[model samples]
Target: MTSRTFAAFLQRSLEELKEQGLYNTIEPLEGPNGPTIAIRGRELVNLSSNNYLGLATDERLVEAAVRAARTWGAGSGAVRTINGTLRLHEELEEKLAAFKGTEAAVSFPSGFACNMAAISAVMGPGDAILSDELNHASIIDGIRLTKSTTIRYRHSDMDDLRAKAREARDSGKYEKIMVVTDGVFSMDGDVAKLPDIVDIADAHDLIVYVDDAHGSGVLGGGAGTAKHFGLSDKIDLQIGTLSKAVGVVGGYVAGSRELVDWLKARSRPFLFSTALPPAAVGASIAAIELLQESRELQERLWRNAAYLQQGLRELGFSVGATETPITPCMIGNEETTQLFSRRLYEEGVYAKAIVFPTVPRGTGRVRNMPSAAHTTELLDAALAAYAKVGRELRLIP
Candidate 1:
């Protein structure tokens, strides 16, 4: 097609998205993504950010970043293979290894890249990956990129997983078998049954990979889902993001020392991509240190989450099967979910809608992330807004 025709097609697609209320319009956060943010000249309660531990705006973290930047300069200058491997990077890796209770750890530029690089590097061609159906998009993409035989089981369904594991092991069509799942399902706020998954992996002799992007710093009093279930020693690969609870920009894989060395020698993202900046590395190290020092933040986070979940439930809104700090209020249709988010925004709350492609079509929801930084007064205000919107939309009677 010519440029004009392609342009017309793009416009039509965007128009269709707008008509369906699925069009995403970016709203610039005037300041840091904290308990509240200024958007469109209004201060709205922020319930959409992944800054679970509220360390993004932490004074200590900022100081650490400044200190590192002053000492190490701005950028790392190249990939890890070249000059990017700074002292801060090594320190961060050591800190992450200790945090996750692993022999060693390897850091990557982002969690998504870590998934893409690690999955593809370790398993390829004739290998089979038994993945959870509700795994994160990054995991799905990584599995696809590997060109491996992918078998998807029902979300957190051990029975289905066992069935698939049996089939994969008995088939004798692949060299290796692996099980992939998110430590926590983001949309539904449910946690992966790590103990069950570990048991299955042991029986099936499958390499286990758990992406604890949403669980790290929130569960196990900060270690993650593996630690929460006391299966840290059993699980083979523990994937995590520094961006969420740690309030930094990067990802990592914590596992056996051999695996870390192997990934350093093999993972394409680590080989080709630029390393994380000194500032981010320093901040992440500080975050991990903070998490280790106290569970006060984690306790407050859960306390806030419980309060929000209870309030939403008492208001007669369905919170689905949330087993973690992530509280998702289900609204059946995509249109309703989007409108619910917009209405919440209008009411000075900033919870975002998760619909259609993010979740299944009928499982659309407005995911509310209650953080430790959120004060009781702020939460009360947000809950009032939710109550008003629920009533207006008839989500609650």
Candidate 2:
């Protein structure tokens, strides 16, 4: 018999998830996460990675990382509050501010930690946050960390936000009020109505926060979602990741100099967590510079997305409303969604199925992320595999 410990609860919980068909099996890629990846010796069209600009394996980024690693060592020696603050990190932050069009920026080890550090640093028990219903898990967790009251508005519903904001402000039960949202919903790929959101925030005198983890390097001509909507100057905080489109690993909060300075003094992550490796910082700087210099990569990403979207629609598969490179082929049943993903893998496409909890129940889908590196032939191959699997499962006629 197994020994009594926390293992029982954990084991039972995992078992329940598997029984409910919610347990996911992770597939380890044999090589870099590029437009094409090898799994068990088979090369497949990789539509599962967040490397939107294909910089993860870019030669320039690789060279920059190698140079930094050679020059700065493999890891940061300490946390930012200590001696871990390196020159490369400072330069990266500078470029980050420029790219996001902010007065200053502060970097974190990851996007999740950035949210945790930034959100909790600003608000507390007496304050309230008006968050979007569809914000990322990181934001939700961050809100939970603070002793603040959270009021969730309907996703992209400006009227709902207005109502919530007014209620929070008039109740006089809170000292500060802020609104937070994902600039682009990762699941459905729909953009947030930032102009309307900004308008509501202005009218209610609420601080505005945007987590543009999926929008940077994909929108605003590669600046970000706030810039895409021409409201960068109006947003109180603009959070973004260096991992997804930048093809590196880090996160940042871009805002006014005073806000950044406050975070530098108050954020727990920056105070306690180790700084990002010099390689990541260097590569991110290079990636942002590249993005600023050219729109070619962004154009390629959009073209690839359009091609796949059109192909899926023509094949009778229901591709959900996506305004970006993320394509969600909806399959309402959970088990079938998992099976569809597996069949697609067998046919040489590597899109993953997202089900309950990640998305609402009865809205399972295979979330495909097309990248700039995908050749036309590779995309065509992916379309063919999707058609084969979708038809085999009777998901499409």
Candidate 3:
């Protein structure tokens, strides 16, 4: 039998969340997660995926995955430190390093795992981390794992970062100091002030770590935020995810050869967890090659993004400070935001409402991710839905 105390605590916590409209209801997709998705047997314009380049459903990637599975079997069969380091894995890493303009790279099972492994591997009790306040949850958790003294500067506020960095450096209390941030703030879609950040890091002699999970495949002709800012050599560590724009599963850290070697030696996830599957590795390699060969997909992605963002703005919906494809129609009240999302779904759009603690309270929104796969017609349909719902709810005049 279960413990009554534990069950009671779970019940109370769930009840409180539901009461506050903070509880999220999961809806399973009936088919492939493409530009359009089917939920509850209804087709809707999909605006909740991170498949920025539509490569997740690309034929070239699918064929590559099939070939890989045929040749390498299903799984890697062990942790990377063991016999799991397949030739295919090495090829993927090589392509990633080349694409990111780095000397070498190390792969992890997921982006979250990459941060967890990399951060804790290099930082410890005597070390300090200066982090952006609005950094992703994975970054926040990774810092916590290190037991390092974490100093949160204002989000993208270089003055605050410089002040904190100088104080941390002058304090002489920590052994190694590192500054970490997201290349693209996923929630707000604003690119990081990387050029300024590199300048500050240069002044303080701090190790610079950037998790360009969203920025990769979308920025710098698909080279990522560091390359977008022409600071690939200046930034110390760069992290990326294959699942987002690459349309596959896994994460990687690219930097100097020494950093890659160090992560391979010390990262716990690499040492403990089983390796990514052959199919995923194969598909990711194809995706990277595709990105390297042409800028057609990136161009399409940006065009669709601009078109949708402009449509929302013309409809008078506030898409807060986004400089990228992630468009959020800001709706302040939690319940109202949820209702708006539901209304959109009813009108055949599948954008989801993001509330705390994904974002701050009273800053709830219906976050829309426009992909290259979405045609102009699909986007227009989504905008029409937005118009009807916004007017019905009196959200727009």
Candidate 4:
């Protein structure tokens, strides 16, 4: 039976969230999440998916998934450390290692799990982690799971990071110090200052961890942010997601063979959570191979992103300081942002609003992701929708 206290707490919390305009109402998509989506019998141009290279719905990947399902059954049937580590898992890890130009790699069920597993496995009470203030929620949660001290430096502030590293190092209160940051900030789409971060880590003998979730398959010819800055060898841990640009599912940490070995041995998620299913593994392998085979998809993605971003800018919408394809159309008010997204839906666009907890208050936005699968005609139509909504909301002149 449900506890009365628990029920009351849940009711009060939900009411508070609703009054604050923080309740997120999810709408189901009627079909595959691709360049376009169907909702309530209406087809809309989808600009909210992380399918950067559009491999999620690619026929090749779909066929690979189907083949894998047939070959390996529906599930791996156990946790990885038990009996679930299939040959496909090994193959996917190998492909990831090759893709990231690392000596080895280890996979996790999800990108969020990678953070929870890796950070807690390697860091603890005797160590300290210097994190970027604007790091993802998963990172923050991972830091919370650790008993280690966490020092947050200002977002992308290299000087603050250096000072924190120096202070932590000089204090000598910890045995190990790691500086962790996202390779590409998801919200703002700005690339991390990896060269500077690497330099600071080198100066202070700090282990470097980069969660390149948003950079993989979009930067460095699709190798990722570390490779983009030619610092692949310098970064101690390079984390990436198969769900994003790879257009599959799962996550991995690519680094030295010793690091991968340590993670395989100690990471809790890899030990307890069920391994990625054969279908996702196969699709991920195909996606990585496709990325390695040619830069055509990436080129298409960049061109589409540039076109959409330019269109928004020309429409007098602020896109923020985005170095990658993730475009955020800034709307300072939460209600307005939600209304703006609803207006877009009515106008045949499917970009969603990001507000409150996802971003800082008063920094709400409608995030647009232009994928490789989208045609110029689709982008032009999306732009037209944006223009209409902006005018209707008085968000643009």
How does each model score on TM-score?
Answer: 0.98, 0.98, 0.99, 0.98
lDDT, candidate 2, residue 186? 95
Candidate 1 global CA lDDT score: 0.93
Question: lDDT tens string, model 4, 106-206?
Answer: 99999999999899988999899999999999988988888999999999999899899999999999999999999999999999999999999989999
Task: Write down the TM-score for model 4.
Answer: 0.98
Backbone atom clashes (below 3 Å) for every candidate: 0, 0, 0, 0
Candidate order, lDDT descending: 3, 4, 2, 1
List runs of model 3 lying over 4 Å from the truth.
none
lDDT of 2 by residue, 1-397 (tens): 4766778988999999888779999878899999999988999899999999999999999999999999999999999878999988899999999999999999999999999999999999999999999899999999999989999999888889989898998898988999999999999999999999889888888999999999999999999999999999999999999999999998999999999999999999999999999898888888999999999999999999999899999999887888888899999888889899989889888999999999999999999999999999998999999888877888888
Candidate 4 residue-wise lDDT at 166 = 97
Poorest 10 consecutive residues by lDDT, candidate 4: 16-25
* Candidate 4 pairs with clashing backbones: none
> Candidate 1 — which residues are off by over 4 angstroms?
none
Model 3 per-residue lDDT at 258: 94
- Model 1 over residues 158-247: C-alpha lDDT tens digits? 999999998899889989999999999988889998888888888989999999999999999899999999989998899999999999
Query: Each candidate's lDDT (Cα)?
Result: 0.93, 0.93, 0.95, 0.94
Worst 10 contiguous positions by lDDT, candidate 2: 1-10
Looking at candidate 3, the ten consecutive residues that score lowest on lDDT are: 1-10
- Give the TM-score comparing model 3 with the true structure, all chains together: 0.99
lDDT of 3 by residue, 78-165 (tens): 9999899999999999999999999999899999999999999999999999999999999999999999999999999999999999
User: Which candidate has the highest TM-score of all?
Assistant: 3
Model 3 score (lDDT): 0.95
